[model samples]
Target: MTQRHDIRLGADIGGTFTDIALDVRGRLFSTKVLTDYAAPEQAILDGIDIVIRDAGIAPGDIGIVIHGTTLATNALIERRGAKTALVTTEGFRDVIEMRTENRFEQYDLDLVLPRPLIPREDRFAVRGRIDAQGRELQPLDEAALEVLADVIAERGFGAVAIGFIHSYMNPAHEQRARDILAGRLSIPISISAEVSPQMREFERFNTVCANAYVRPQMADYLSRLQVRLKEMGAGCPVFMIHSGGGLISVETASEFPVRLVESGPAGGAIFAADIARRFGLERVVSYDMGGTTAKICLIEDYQPHTARTFEVARTYRFCKGSGMPISIPVIEMIEIGAGGGSIAWVDAMGRIQAGPESAASEPGPACYQRGGERPAITDADLVLGKLDPDNFAGGKIRLSLDNAGAAIARDVGDRLALSPEAAAFGIVEVVDENMANAARVHAVENGKNISENTMIAFGGAAPLHAARLCEKLGVERCLVPQGAGVGSAIGFLKAPFGYEALASKIMGLSKFDAGTVNAMLDDLKATAEGFVRAGTDGAIVREITAFMRYAGQGWEIPVTLPDRAFAAADTAMFETAFKQRYARFFGRAVEGPEIEFVTWSVKAQDVRPEGERFVLETDGAAVAVPARRGVFDPASGTVLETAIVPRDTLCPGARVAGPAVIVERETSTVVTSPFDAVIQVDGTILLVRKGR
Candidate 1:
């Protein structure tokens, strides 16, 4: 027997919309509201009110609240975080600015780089020296930190970040500096030893600085949100989803806000993985396209790929090393500024450019008619007749076709010497190509071929272009799951309470130190379990991975370790594991090279529920069509009559041919000529190529 008292709520705030989902026992209710940048929590509150009301539940009945947001990522990209100061080891104040000294783009002589978050004037160094082996060569200068605290206070800094050299090996210096500074200054402090605790001084330092930069803002917002929720009678325990696709206590989220950078997209990836698992699918591609960006992630064996480090706000969208790297557990994916509100234009070379930029929600696409004059992807879709002007957002928002055409004519059509319809088609095609290129690159990087993987498309704009994306990628099938528009929010509701802890200590396989390594792993495992226990008393599963590399190699590949204690005799097993994992990428490993372990990670999470298999009700009678409309056909470069069918009217196994529009309350899916759609038992719209 199930109790109705276990009510859970989820909120996901993206670049454009704030989605809210309420799981009352087993039934789910959701709503979407435009994100209010000025007071982002207001949108969450508004959406929450709607969903809980529609669910026929009072706020007091909600026992848990889970949230994920893109505010940290946006602030880092826009350089709008709090006034921050950084404390570093003596003579290394510029390590973040220096970066790794490797040029990702070798040919560009005048390439610009991302600016460091903390400027030189605000970065102060204390006399402290710690060796890579955790030896304190020079004691931290307490008096110098006192002076630096005055300087920080004089500059009115809201937060301070401490990143001493070799802190990942030993954090004593950073911890002392933080204590001394805390005694003198009244501001939040973030230490690399606590935030990242990983090797690589530059990435570790920048990550702490980033965590400090956004800590104040996130703390304030979270505080107010708690108060508002309490007022609304939903004063339950509030948790946050991190970029690693794990739930954490709000306290942890406020302390290391940088972990939330890719939180929203992480949820989307989790959603796709859950969908794949529900249908027993193995190879899956998760595509999430919202108003401001699109994210592509690969899922294998019912899990989204995980990364120990990821870049944020890349100057070059596809360039690997062009952004600020943060060492943290994160969902591996590629994000591009190609989405519904991506502005379309003709670049200097007269080539059509979609974007690494967006209009966002406020002053959104021109067709939104909220003061935007630029042509965006949504406007192009409208001009191309793919979107309904009068029935947009379930008639909640009335789109303007005139605005869409005018903006397209001015920005793209005129420059290309083409009609608005032609320009719309071109814009849509260009954006589609951009997304496809991202997908292809991501696939190759992951040693995958997308032609064999099924695409799970979601978010507000994904289904709108998913069919075409499939065509471009040569993917035979794409599934737009139920509540696709609020997919990430729904994912949050289903996510497990988990956390990851990392530690770095260089060791060789020849002298395997199992005792020392096991001690470290024990501490990390306990840390992860503490976080998971904060959410529930369910059984916890633990996974350990080591970053191993051939001695003298610049990088290491993650190797999953088998559960149980390691012994001296396990050295051969270690070598075999490294070679096998290495061969998967480089075709073969270099034999006889000394192997070393650089970093170790431990993840702990609750056991996930197994989804029940469902069969489509194919025996149902034929469903009725809702309406009919004219949609632009890119194949013919002209408007063609399209059947407008309400998604509710399409029950399980209901089939609809191409050149149709399936309308739902949140978003619409355009079934192109090359594909046909069938409704699954779980309300997923499965689009398969015709005659396949």
Candidate 2:
């Protein structure tokens, strides 16, 4: 095992900012910088240098570095990945195009479904047939792989994804094809059996195709990042955070890069979960609004709820089936194209709308003077006095109020016949409402209530808009954790080193075969252990899981297996537990039909994160006030003078009322008309709805 004294680092790259954190004995230091999407590694190195300096440590003293990024997500959204191809069994070339057959907008006949990741021309099929029971009905032809490899290479493709029929049940054929294609092409390969070992050919195949599409780009960037870190005298073992709220080695991340799609937002969810645990809160909603997007995730009972599938790079706003599906264990959340940098525009109907298109960092906003002419949410916030022009990004970058107001006035105000300030408020309110609507839909779909969940707000822009969001959701309280500006980076430290392995197999409880179940479980254990061994050196690991199902009738809810593998004698116990879980999810369980298991999952995790907790110093009380600022309030329908209080001045138990501003070095949290906040024991400010 590695020594406990080694220092660990974590970095998260977002659309608007790149965040970095250093954890030495569980004490975290962090920093945020503008993301360099053109050369993403540069921002990573810069943030690393800042964080290492903040920790007062030499770069060479660092031991392990874990990174999380939205790069793959962004690349898919912006269409910047390598040209890729998908090879599948004959007659299944249109599987991705066919999709789920459910229309996102059932009423609109003209609605265009999202385009497939691989075009029709890029899709090739081979002759092979595997049945549902892992039986090969038609033998795989060895000659086809060579022909496909030549055609794939001739097209100058960078990566290829192979997803044959029933590969999830038996991967032998896919493995054979991969071996045959190894020497014929230099491109990377992704097999559905390894990427998503589940039923549903459309989703599994899409997941593998997405992974292959982004592998080459992710690998090249990671290699350059490693070299740059070493050049700066840091010889740390780099780690990457996966979307499942766990950490894995960078080498594993480079191979299966699709898992990193929601990696940044996943880190934020972990941070929120940790905060919930510390404060003893049972239900919390993590709100992370960075430069280009805002993410909302629900955490309950000190852990975030995870999903087996996620959609990436959706074309339409708030549409679920509008994106390609990736089958992996992910901390389920809802994301929207509403953030500080989301561009605002006046539509043909003259209705002002905030984005699903971001200006990004290079040409951030009109206020940044980086050649951006479009009006953005941040520009509007500055125009309405919600943001301090001089204190933006800890005063590292100055905002131009004239440019912001002028852009909003010319772009939106002129069309709506309103003043720039009114237009700016409209933009802010519309974006907030968009985010609020997304949150409500997500919660409703997951069989949850938004009002019952506590809101944990982070990211550079979240603190500024969190109180408003809480009001919109009817949430009683909100938590703004310390270092909220670089929330995802801090979240990286809170994550555990782990991996999830899954497989789909048919099993009927009526004729339950203990041997088959045990064998399948063993195979899953071996796969998880193989990944863990590559990342950690003899670390203690535990396997846990549940069987997936629909309630009652023919399916069973996920019943957790015992620590040891299943035995023939335990079949009755398993059935009893499944009945209880089924009743819990749905009101009751049916007694007549036989229960079936569609798929099973196994997750391996370390005993703890890479360090021991260190005691932190708590602040006493502040003795001074900053100043006052007049801010426009929509609730009041006018501008009012509001007191500005620095966050550092408030101590634990100190209370602040609404119509006040709590400013910090990195960002500000606004206490609005009906909200009041009190500092908690752990230095987190808890904002609760108050009776005025």
Candidate 3:
């Protein structure tokens, strides 16, 4: 069992599937397994066994393992995490509960805000105060903290979160409180300053509480995964991908599990960004449709858009401000509960509605014949003849068309007074429109046109619906990359060892001090670099950003700063940058309002080699069709004979006309009647609109 440094493994545990990808030098081997809820790690192990066997490599030969999961997010959403207590400043005990007091749904008088993670009884307040200028306003009551620690110990709380007023500016009080609690309690303790150091008490407090809520569960899961992997002969160091689309040591992940909330989806964005870079596409709409959820992200200039804060478990139609805010660096994306297993049912309004709930992997879709009585999106896809009944998941799990048809007929067809095929078509159309509307909203929010961007579709279910999605969005081209089924797992292998550190220090342009700003930025840079160094000693790249806003404004926009030391003369440059960015965001900038810098961020990452350029082939010879099948065409509103081509047999420069199914082991790409498919030099399937 000789070690092979070139052998790296990447695993992503989604809600419905655990995808494993093995990279043997430049070659890739991948597989997907049904997620085991009771023992999630078991699915990863099973997937690993499959890929390693296919790659002809032993577990001991693996050099490194990169893993991502949705466990932390699910815990918060399901309220299944450990019992947690919140310790905050006396008057600010209700910060998380109070939220920002903004109405996400203004017209609904009965709207109920999401309950805080820590119940009111579990929240304790102490005597402490830190001013906005990082100055101590009141001394922390050490005795109060010691007494609270004893109370926490006696109550058997699994985790504790401490978030004092203005802790982001001065963390001395919060640190002291955590030290007192750690000495008395054996449970994990989290401080808001370390979890989310930016301003805004509501978001910061909620972030730390969320971290503490899931700390015990995530730590236990990650520990068990490592132990199991070691038992199976994989002794390589394991790293977890964070929500920022970077690899961090498992130790860091355990301490800051909140950062891993969007880890799996971040990988998908990174995969699409890499594909965009290779193909030289400047603006790409990254569409990832897995079994339980679908995510859409905007990638521009060969990088996925990033944000300093994002919400989790949106409860109101995935509306902004309707979920728990996590103030951590993350890749920005819009996620909807529209996936293969998303449940579809007729609403009270007699309209077909897809999910914010899913069957997940346990029962899966009705077509899986796993005791799921309800019809799901997968059942609709099956009933519509988009999926092959005999060869799903490479035939490892046989699909039952009878089961699918029966479920749809019982639930939707009978209720809607339509045949199963028609009902299935209606269901698919509803879900697709849901996704398309989401994409449209996301692009408009970002001030971009959806039709102007090329789409890069991945995940098992994305390609099956991508062609139709393109038609709806008026997108001219879509790229279904190689190994699309396990795109996120493959993304983990491509991610760099990186970290982002954020801090808050209010500074007005009129009173700007270059020395103070430089010192703060230097501290942040060192902190980010230290985290990156834990994983690699390679050359590092640094990026700096300033969150800026006009005086008396409630929100700010990010302005990227030059990656160099600033001087007193640079104040005007900073003002100019903010003005330009502000104009771009709002179409105009106010000249009289004084500008201020609210927050600063530093991101550091180890450099990696760039991928080779991909040349798309437009003119190619038609490929031989292995078979033909009766597939439903939405454009024609009828089932038509379509060519089915084996993906493995199609070489570079191969082309297939519209109404074709490019079949592969992991997933299939359905080229609709309006588009034609061409095999690129890198084995990517390019779907272009007819006469484009």
Candidate 4:
């Protein structure tokens, strides 16, 4: 039996900063470092060393490491990945190019669609046919595959993605193609049936192609990182957080790299959900504003919203159907390119716009003084007196106010004929409104109300803007939890060792087959449990979901089923569940319409970690502040004097009236004039509307 060590590690690699947290016997130690564009692993190693030193422990004391990164996402967006090829069914060469054929920008005549990840030149088609119902028509041609392998090897392709039509129903053809290709080609092969085995051909194909495109790169990186960690004397096994907020072994992650695309943001969602559960809040909005992007996820009943499919790298930031669709289980959220490093500038239409682009870490915000000339959100925050120049990043990196002022003045102030102070204020308000709108849209789409939810904010920049975001959305309360700066890393530490397996097998309640359903579910449960066993020797929990829909409906909704074996009588239970979920989404269910099941999912995990529950109450006392500073307020369009309070000095139930700044090591909280800040029982800063 393996021993459970007291020390564990969690690392989150954001676009601008790589956050690391070490949980030693429940006490946390964390640090933030600039992301190394050339070598991401080097940054992690460096930060790990620093954090271990700070915790006064040796590297060998750590038992496990859980990591989450945006590398796959950034690679897809920036078009940086290994040379990849696609092998598809004959006569379907243009399916990826002619995506769903929907115009995201319908009104614009000259709309630009995003370029497909696999170019036509690299895509190869094979002569094989599998009918939609698992029937074999034309067998896979090995001769054609052999020739294609020769051509692929000649072209020096690093990876190959095999996605035959209807492979999800019968993976025999795809598996045969992989075996044949392996004999002649020395490269990684990704099949749609294994990566994303759902029904939609376009989505399954695209997802497998993406996985192959980044397989070699991610595998090499993970291998090198593990080797380096062992050399440094920390030889503990490392796990990765998947996009669905579950931990998988690094080997599994390397094979299914696409699952890691939104992994970092998923950790943030898990963190918010954990906070919501601790506070006993039912409805909450997770606000994670980091260096490169801001992610907003809605949580109800301590669960983050999940979706079977999500888009990646949207070409039009505000438009749907403008990006590559990947078929997988993921935590659903709205991620916009608005963060502390989001560049601000005047657009050609004589209007100011904050990013859907970012400065990242290399030439971060102008306030960092690292050769950045473009004005960014951090620069605006500095100009607005929201950040302490000398105490930024726990005084590790001093900010340059002059650089921020010059950059903003040259880029935005000159264009608008306004001072840099006014431009900075405009930048902040615009970004805040952008985040607010994203939250609103996400909530509305999910059939939820944003104003009725409490905002749980975290990340390096979330605390700074969370209160204002709540104010814009008409929210009553917002909580900046303990260690908000490295919240995602902390989230990783709290994640359960788990895996989910999905199978697409069409079935209907009218002709329910209990034996077949039980067999399929049993297989999925075994597969999921096998993965979870890699991390622990403990009792595990299982959950199953069935994707169901009315007959002739294009989309399906998830209806959770009991973990036990399905019996003949359970058909009525399934029907009732389907009807209830359908009513919740569409407001009504037709009595005569036939309902069919599309897919099945099984998730197994070690029991979730529990936290000590506590109640938050107010003591009705005020903490005295020592000094004040001039801060910019867009509500009044002028600078005002604001109190500066140290975060550690505040006791439970102590309150401070805004405008005020709560300063901490990793981040700062900006309490707007209309809100008052109070310290909760768990050292969480709760900001509330003045009259609420």
Candidate 5:
């Protein structure tokens, strides 16, 4: 038999599962394994073994490997990274601790801010100064840095971060300090200029500190993964998906692991955007509900929204300013603690609440019966008949119904004075409402109406709850694409080799220096292209963006720029573009204050083949029901005999009226009584309102 070399593999390590997707040519084979938190890579190897065996192929036949993980994000949230120190310009050591000095919850008298990653005692100061115009005002205090290095070595610090005032405008001071420290300490060092060159001292300093904090752990894990894959005879080039929905070489990912903070969720957004493009849907809302959390992203014109900064681990009810801010190119989205393994309990107010805490894969939900006693969303789902005990994960792990009921009854039912089934219903409703409210807030913040967009739901648990969520949000349509269980892993196969580089240079449109602007943009373009060229020699496409705001504004909005040389005559064009974008964002543009460009971004990517168009069939024969089971219907508030149909048995255009459960190996789609399901030509399940 001939061996094939066109095989690609994508692996995603979430909090509760390690999902693997293998693409041989165009065919996909996927599986989900319980996450081995102690040794995450071991789960990946185990999953790879299963898919390759089923595909009748050897590990050597794989051509490339793409991986995304939440390890960096988890390390930050769990505070499990190495002991790290921060070095900043003298008198500015408390910038991260002070934050922006704004209250996230202004009315709360007992509000407490999230602690900085590096403590005040661990932060040291050195005398150095740089002006706002890329000029050094004072030389770096090398003597002070040398003395600090000795203190750091004595204290046994594992990593160091250096952030100097105005480092984004001039990096010489910060760079010089790093050289001095690197000469004495044998530890990882991160500088703000290289990590995040945008303005704003607090955000830039925090970002570099985060990068250094997670550097050692991420580097070690990536190295071990490479060695293990090689030992398994899969000598393919390993790449990593970043938070910006692009692929980068492993070497780059290791150097800047902060870019991988939201990598996993970014892939899910890319998956939904790709589907929207194929279906010609201009507006979309992507819903991804995995084991530990659920992510919601808004897509416009077939592209997911992008942002320059995002907060991590929001400590105050997922509020914007309540978490550590990391300034990097990222896909903007809102994530809530609503997922399969999220815990459910009664709060101080005597109301049932779903979690910001998860049971994870260690013990998982009560139904897994590993040792968990707390009731989780998954346990409630099982009690409500949304999950099949004998068929979960293709029967690899059997669920215990008795254990689920006991746990729910003990944790929630007794307190609420409700039956076990009633308690289960309450848990499910709370989580579903949480997700729906998040979607509504996300849309309103973006000046969009939630009901006008089609929902594209994925992940292992999204399909099971999407119909009810749609009903809550007034959405009329939802699409559950094939391979929805391992959506992020499959998205890795679709991401392009790309990178975005940013630099801050404030310039008023009236004083636009065509020569200076051209030179600055050219430098940024080269830097971005260099990152992409490391992975591919294919044709490259470049995009330019200028972050502009009226003079004296604290923040700016992005304006697209043509990828061409600029001249003084184009100043008016810049003004006009800013006004148009401003009006689109805020309803009207102000004619007064002069507009100034604050930051410039250039993105380079390898061109990918266009996806084929998807056409839906409006009419089809009803699919056969192989069996029927009593499932709880939230709308009717009673148990109904629902049709249980295997997904593989449904042909394209086959229709099934609710209430029905379309079961597949990785997940299940629950069509509520108010909605009907139809299989599209590409095997995507389309759920629409009963009369729509």
Candidate 6:
């Protein structure tokens, strides 16, 4: 009864690689190619070509194509976007510069925060003002805007951002400014009223600026990709994944490109949730380590945790509140600059230091021998004999062990007076610890204890490092899902066509206006449904979310409304629900304090198919045999002969005493002494405590 014409394709473009997947009736096929930063769409086409050929399906058979990429995020971080300008209220031209004045690191007297994207000269203020109660205090000046438009035209800015103070509460002034600019210039304009209608001026302004900054670039790329796909005989609808784990129309993505900053990682979270659902896992931590970055996220009850805002390119790789924050619904996660291509070096203290910077794929690590002379994490893994040089990347790219040794010896061994092997071990250990530290911090911040949660590791580099991370985080089990190397791309196949719309309105619960609130909710619901319908074929949409809050809660918590709209009788119900969620999070809802709704969000999603459950193995065991290899264990402080086993040879329920290595095709797992390892029913390696 099933037709082959309904195949779905998904792709995730990262800094180092582009992963592609095709799913036909729940069966999946995937492939990977080096990301062509110069022309990213070329990489997508190449990978798609391979996958479709492998699946033996015609391009026209594809019904839908879903994509997630870090192109916007990379453009923001690397400052490689369109030349853009910002328009704001006359008195608040520097709001982006005057970010929240709190120092995330208080003890350091001199701390450097991230610089605002818009420079002082590019920030021009238009005459306008709005109150917190959706009232326009001063009308937007038309004559002033005419002069500003000429100035912008002279500068030839590609895009413009308008973020008047309190515009979130009252968008009239911002909308008027946008209209003036639209007529005067041929460039796209982003208004804070729609981009981030939240009470926080700093976050709202940043979001608008980011959207403007990347709009031109995203538009160009998506247009070209559409043309290319059509030429390839593919007539499928193209949808882009948003940071909130939902698919949006390509047009929407181009308009608000900032929403795509965490798009790739969001897909990985969705993939982990799918795996968790298949096995009935209640709590899981998804770990995805690629070549340039490692991302960690928490999933509770098969849903990735979501946040109203996310930071990009933190100066301190693992520190929160140290980067630019954009107000968008994103899957909450922590990312560190520790990954496969992270450079390894000896610091002034003669200790090994792994990165917050990457060599990337061009020259890549020393083992790649693509003209790179620097030692890197991948090089270290090769030096330790953990990676098969000839079999790297399924032998698509050969590795050079000599090049790795030479780079490590010259850069690290010479300074530390240690052998290359020892230096490689040091780099590996430090990077693993950095990843573990990030995991620990993210868990604590989210009120989670990782010891009880199963670790689902994916991406090309994760399985290689999962066991070590588990040891550091005190986790007992690790699962490498099928097609783990291209996990995020696979995740795109599991996401629903969805979109979220938010607006800022100052409303007090004590004096709630039901009619006004109902109208606003109705507008947002329709907006979300319009987006979902554009990319999906007559799929039904489901609405979900909640209010965001503080302790007396002058600001309200983002509360999830029931499936129905606000009823005249439900005002009290809304208040009660808000109070209960507030108390549950903070332990107490202060009495007699008024609560205000800062923002309201409405999300619309298309229902997806249920995944089949796979059984766990308890009786079948892995045939364990240990081959010896010299490895430097930090705990022992010396090189020792360690036992190694082939990962595939191990059957479910097979136990291996640790101080062992489990090698697979793409990656390896290391089990240290005092921790015993077993193959779980789902083909994942479970390392648990044993009587040593």
Top lDDT hit:
5
Off by over 4 Å in 1: 1-5, 615-624
Ranking by lDDT: 5, 3, 4, 1, 2, 6
Q: List runs of model 5 lying over 4 Å from the truth.
A: 1-5
lDDT of 1 by residue, 632-691 (tens): 876566788888898877778788888888988888999998888888888898898877
- Could you tell me every candidate's TM-score relative to the true structure? 0.98, 0.95, 0.99, 0.99, 0.99, 0.94
Cα deviation of 105 in candidate 4 (Å)?
Answer: 2.1
> lDDT by residue for model 2 over 381-410, one digit each (tens)?
888787888888778889999999999999
Model 5, 251-363: lDDT tens digits are 99988999999999999999999999989899999999999999999999989999999999998765789999999999999999888999999998889999989999989
Whole-model lDDT for model 2 versus the true structure? 0.83
Count of residue pairs whose backbone atoms collide, per candidate: 0, 2, 0, 0, 0, 16
Better of 1 and 6 by TM-score: 1
Pitting candidate 4 against candidate 5, the one with the higher lDDT is 5
lDDT of 6 by residue, 1-692 (tens): 11122588999998778889899776777877888988999999998888888888888989888999999998999998889899998988888998988788888788997889999999998777787777878888989998889999999899999998887767888888888888999999999988888778898999999999999999999999999999999887788999999989889999989989999999999999998898788999999999889999999999998888889988876677899898998999999888898888877887788887788887789888788999989998888766778777767789999999999999998888889887888888899998988988898887778788989998888877787788788887677776788899989988888888877776666667778877888888898888887865655666556564533444455677787656568767777777788776678776676666657778888778786886543233445475778755544666667777877677667877767777764456666664667777666666565642
Which scores better on TM-score, 2 or 6? 2
Evaluated against the true structure, the overall lDDT of model 6 is 0.83
On residues 1-692, what C-alpha lDDT tens digit does candidate 4 reach at each position?
A: 35355898999999999999999998889989999989999989999999999999998999999999999998888989989999999999878999889888989999988888999999988898999889999988889999999999999999999999999889999999999999998899999999998898889999999999989989999999999899999989899999999999899999999999999999999999999999899999999999999999999999899988899999887678999898888999999999899999998987889997899998999999899889999999999999999999999889999999999999999999989998998899899999999998999898988999999999999999998898789898999999999999999988888888998988878998999889988988999999888788888999899999988999999998888988989878999999999999999988998899999999888886589786755334788987899998665667889999999999888999989999998999999898889899778998988877
Worst 10 residues of 1 by lDDT: 614-623
C-alpha lDDT values of all predictions: 0.89, 0.83, 0.92, 0.91, 0.93, 0.83
